[model samples]
Target: MASFFRSAVSPSSHPSPQQAAAAAVAAAGDAAVKNLSSTFRLPFASLWSQSAAPLSGQRAAAQAAAAAQAAALAHKEAAAAAVHASRQSTYNTLFTILAVVATILITEQVLYRRKKAHLPGPTWTIPIIGKFADSLRPSLEKYQAGWNSGPLSVASVFHIFIVIASSNEHTRRILNSPMYAEPCLVASAKTVLCADNWVFLNGKAHVDYRRGLNTLFTRQALATYLTIQEKIYRSYFAKWLADPSPAPTPYMMHFRDLNMETSLRVFCGDYIPDEGAKQISDSYWLITVALELVNFPFAFPGTKVYKAIQARKLTMKWFEHTARESKKRMAAGEEVTCLTDAWVKAMIDAREGSDKLADESRKVLVRDFTDREIAMVLLSFLFASQDAMSSAVTYLFQHMADRPEILRKVREEQYRIRGADLDAPLTLEQVDDMEYTKMTVKESLRVKPPVIMVPYVARKPFPIDPSYTAPKGSMVIPSFWNSLHDPNVYPEPELLRPERWMEGKDSPAELNPKNYLVFGSGPHYCIGQQYALIHLTAVLGTASVLMNWEHEITPLSEQVE
Candidate 1:
């Protein structure tokens, strides 16, 4: 290996060859070093320059965290703005609702205010308390003022809308439409006459009960009452002349008392003791006063109800006593003389007799009425007759005084009908024969009715006049004055013309048949109408014979008060 190496080295050992090889190797090595240094210097310089503001991963992460925090703050601000906007929107909605509610209340008040403006009433209503002042102090002057306000007007008292039907047709409609109206007899009616009285019955109950009462007013029964009434009138007429006077004082109270006496005697025979009758008559006025058109509808002490209750207690005792006596007498087989006896006897006859209750004609046979029931029925009759008869009596006296010529004719007629025995009990035919007296009574009633208007409640909403519908629960009144005073029917509405009935004219016939609501029109009409007419006729006839009566007319008397 040494020898071969030496041989090879021998050629390399030559100075020229070895030196040229070394120079080439050294030059290549130097060029490589220079390139490496140049690359390294640039990279190192770049690294050194970045090191002045170095960005580490941790620093980048910290910057990112800061940005996230800022974004979260921005989100919180945006959410807060959204919540604030929502709150503002809620407040605006609430404000709008309050405004709307306030507007509705204001509108209702305005409408209510306007409705009361045009009515023919006081200039300024007492705010929400309309007509209460007038209601508390019901004056005749105030009533007339209200009447003359217009043909139709309205008033609100205790929230009761009273529509005054001044015309006869309207009044008739109010009374006749029993389905639409029921009599709200002054507030004291229920108290004076017990609440369970048949007069308070309505609809089918009223009709059925009234049917039973029809027998009591039969032609024969009326004849009996006529005899009793004639006797009572003759006696009372003599008493009127016992203490004589030239000028007439107000006889309204006297007439009312006379009528009450007659009513008690007629209904109860001798059962109502003299003292009891006088007490009942004297104290009855309290009932009248209590039964005012407007009254406090409560039973509290000192109220109308309290006073009426007292009156009822006093009268009911007498009536109940009469019923008990009548029942005992009837049970003992006593002969029937007066209305009570006759009624009691009939009831006994019916109950003992073999009569089918279902047979309408057989039902004409009176059933046994309880003492309380009889008392209530008697009270009903008294209530029905009291005001109306008093009014008729007053008008009769007034008419006789005002028109002396008419009184003379009536006196002549009475003398011709009852000859010299003026004290004799007049028969039904005799009472009927006094045609002029009857005519005068009718004329007087037409001119000045006792009860001006009959009030009825509308049971359902009624279409009264085509222009206006009666609001449900509103009063719809129809007046008889229109029919009685109609110019077309009477020719002279203001004049006291009695020949209208005698002449049988078309106007008279029209007014007489369908339009007259003097005793009411329906099944609920006055049951004592025949007896009432006969009693009035007897009184006037007897007065014509025995006493000369006069009326001191007053401005207030003719007025509404």
Candidate 2:
């Protein structure tokens, strides 16, 4: 880490005062002394002879005192020399350390710049924690400055260099080029998610792992999950209606609770108790806050990361315990009730070679996953969806309420699809038929994207553009805000207009596939995107029909938080 007066000089031409005095004495000599009063010399000679003994004794005493003073001065000079030497040694040591540190920091900066090439960014990075303070308190204005700079830009935090791709082309390139780059999430993700989690896998490993889990989000699987989703939403709405605080309180936390409860039920089902769901939901906020862009790396006590880890541990314990119970139930030939049972049944059928149950594709990679492995996968899904789903739910409500006409259209579609029974659960076909609801959900996500950007690490030099090659081990970020809100793609992108996605005419925005990055693009795109969108659409649709709700605009509510 790149971690902040005396002079005795004289002119050579001038003589010292002692030297000048000696020279004057040598020039005058005895001749000048003889010219004095010789007349008084005879009488003075007798007095001088008598006083000679006493004068010599006084001179000897004076000489002895002068010698003692000279010895003391010499001793002081020796002590001063030792102190000067000690100071010099300390100075030399500090200089060497600073020089070494400076060299390392300079080299790091030079290499960072060299990798950047023609990219738009700082020529030299701030030493150590560059842009850390800004990231700690993120702002749209600062992020906009980067996106506006060029297609690509650079930044660093805590010695980790980051290259940001802000343009649609570059952003898609980074997401598609999985061989050159992989998702790193953030600095502390490994600690929070566990290094062994399947979500951290890359290359063939990541593909294989994801393929097995792909069955969980299949169209058939989502149909089953919807049954659980609507039940929770209904119960929560009644609670909200009964609550004392009906004066337009902040709904962000309420939405978080809704999403968390829905997710837990939809994943674990009856295997996890109501108390278990509430416990997980309450503690899950720690994980959400800990996953911010910049956070303390260590999980020391009292830190957000520590609390998040503890919450993770608690959640995982329940997940693994549920998995074990599900496996036992499956072994006893119990019917599948939830995702855990579904997964365990598939593994069992594949192992036993049940021709009716084992599909040809699943048979190839069919093996029983460990309880811990299943728990980790479930936890990974929760971690990815928790905050993002909450954000999407909140904004969807806010946007719909702010525009009541749109909400009216959405409610019309909902009531028509479900008929007179407002409490009836929706099937996959019912969700698909609600075009306006889907459009509303789509527009809401675009206006307030849950994930602003994603972080990826370069395995090797990544030539995202002709001029710029992200260096090995550099973190590259692809920003989504610009892509989603590109005015050219969606005219007046800031407006929450769902008609842009409707099939009125073949407009450029509706015609362009690239314009829609709500679920991202390419091979590493969101796995459960379908499930997530449908879930939100279902929530908004159901909320429209069941409850009378209104959006209260606050001074700060309109601003992107």
Model 2 vs truth, CA RMSD? 17.9
Model 2 compared with the native: what TM-score? 0.85
In angstroms, give how far residue 107 of model 1 lies from its true place: 9.4
Write down the lDDT of every candidate, Cα atoms only. Answer: 0.73, 0.83
Residue-pair clashes per prediction, in order, are 11, 0
For residues 127-217, what per-residue lDDT tens digits would candidate 1 score against the true structure?
4556777777766556666666766667665556667776655565666576777776765677667789888788877877776666677
Ten-residue stretch with the least lDDT total in model 1: 354-363
| Residue 363, model 1, lDDT | 66
Best by TM-score: 2
Cα lDDT of model 2 by residue, 371-487, tens digit: 999999899889888888988898888888888999999989988999998766788999999998998898889899988888999999888888767888999999898888888
Off by over 4 Å in 1: 1-125, 136-152, 244-248, 353-367, 505-512, 552-557
User: What global local distance difference test value does model 1 have?
Assistant: 0.73
